[model samples]
Target: MIVLGIESSCDETGVAVVETGAQPVPVLRAHALHSQVEMHQAYGGVVPELASRDHIRRVLPLAGQVLADSGCALADVDVVAYTRGPGLAGALLVGAGVACALGAALAKPVLGVHHLEGHLLSPFLSQDPPEFPFVALLVSGGHTQLMQVDGVGRYTLLGETIDDAAGEAFDKSAKLLGLGYPGGPALSRLAEQGDPAAFKLPRPLLHSGDLDFSFAGLKTAVLTQVHKLGAELQARKADLAASTEAAIVEVLVKKSLAALDRSGLQRLVVAGGVGANRRLRAQLDAACAKRGVRVHYPELALCTDNGAMIALAAAMRLQAGVQQPSDSYAFDVKPRWPLDLTAIA
Candidate 1:
């Protein structure tokens, strides 16, 4: 089966095609993505109205590109899938509308997928895909969560951020350092030249016993440090960045390990934009290796929001017999849907 997926959740417009049934995991045939980072850079963040408009202009062209790249025609798609929730309402609407319209025109079924589920299942598209019954750390700009994933659509929320997520801490902290838009990457790059122990930063909830996360206090701590440094901020920027990244990575690593120990799961999967962080990956790899635990990750290119994960998720859902696409063109999107609330088999 061929599934055409569309993703317009936030700042990126993505489209892709995936072929399933021949392998245990769906194969990504082709995918296209257009990032609005440059466009949003001027604003220091995403503008909901601008993002919705850009999605309108880019989604179809991206779809065409992926279809061409995959050597597939419109008629060959067995299902049309799109991210349906936990994002900007306008952005979600654009993809949902286009997906339903295409499904109606082509007379094919359409499926609405949870955005976080797309991230959670993304590692299945990796070259070294992980088996089911693993722990997943989903650290994205809008969310940070730990889940026990038994299989497609079967997820138990282990813990999540109560305030700002890890990504938010990174971005907001970078902003405190006068870094421009897309601050996380900028801060990370600068962190490479400094010492992780250069400054003290809090690791919230690291010893609370439970698995929940909190980064809001850490952001405040960064602000305090910025003010303390005052005129010396410029000279210590890289050190501060390194220290900030260290604090966040420490909490994430410890919590992830706690989740694994609690669940007795030997496999771990890390997904979402923050999962692309080099420090997080390196630490997780080293820690998991010591315990002889297998860790899985999507290719770096797939770590961000993309159509490939969306399409692969839809295919896996169908293969697992937990969901069925609808023939009816009428559709609605849930901007705050919970991943654990999705269909489970």
Candidate 2:
């Protein structure tokens, strides 16, 4: 089945074509993505209204690009898939509207996919894919969670952040250090040049013997350090960045290890934008290797929000006999949907 997937749940307008076969094999023909990062940079965060309007403008063009790149036609698409919720309501509606309209015109089925489920399953599209019943660490700008994935649509929440997500902490800490928006990548680059031992930051709730995470306190700690440094510590910015990265990575690694041990899952799949973090990757890779466990990550480009993952997820759901939304389906954006919802099955 050829599935056309649309993802406009956030600042990115992503469209992709995915082919799913009966042998549990999925192939990506082509995907096109347009990011609104530059537009949101000045605002220091995503403006929901602007993001939604841009999606309306970019979705069709991106979809056309994907079909052209894949040498496929609109009539060849077997199903239409789109993000249903857990994002900016307007942004979600933009994609939902386009997908529903296109599906209706084509007389094809439309599946509403969970945004986080796309992230969790993203690694399967990679070369070194993980099997089911593995541990998943999902760390994105808006969410942080560890889950035991038994199969498609089968997830058991293991742990999650109680306050700010790991990515948010990285961005907030970067802003305090005078770095611009989207701090995860920028702060990581600075960390490469500095000593990780320069400043010791706390690893909150790491050894709490529970699966819950807490990065809010760590962000506060960074703020306090910045206040203490005053103007004279500008020269030590790289060191601060490195130390902060190390602290965050340590907590994540420790907590993930705990989850793996508790679940007894030898394979770990890391997803979400923060899954692209260099230090976090290195730490998890090394830790998992030492414990005789395997680790998998989506291709670096797929770590963030994109249509390919959404498309792939939709294809899987269709293959699994998941119900399709009705023609009279109304747009419903879930700004706060839980990933463990059984209805998705």
Compared with the true structure, all predictions reach lDDT values of 0.95, 0.89
Give every collision pair in model 2.
none
Please provide, for model 1 over 85-174, each residue's C-alpha lDDT reduced to its tens digit, 9 standing for 90 to 100.
Answer: 879999999999999999999999999999999999999888899998999999999999999999888899999999999899999999
Q: Model 1: how far is 221 from its true place, Å? A: 0.5
Off by over 4 Å in 2: 322-328, 342-345
lDDT of 2 by residue, 75-180 (tens): 9998888998789999999999999999889988788889999999898889988888899999999999999998888888888999999999999999999889
Global fold similarity of model 2 (TM-score):
0.97
Alpha-carbon TM-score of each model against the true structure: 0.99, 0.97
Best by the lDDT measure: 1
Off by over 4 Å in 1: none
Where is the poorest 10-residue window by lDDT in model 1?
A: 336-345
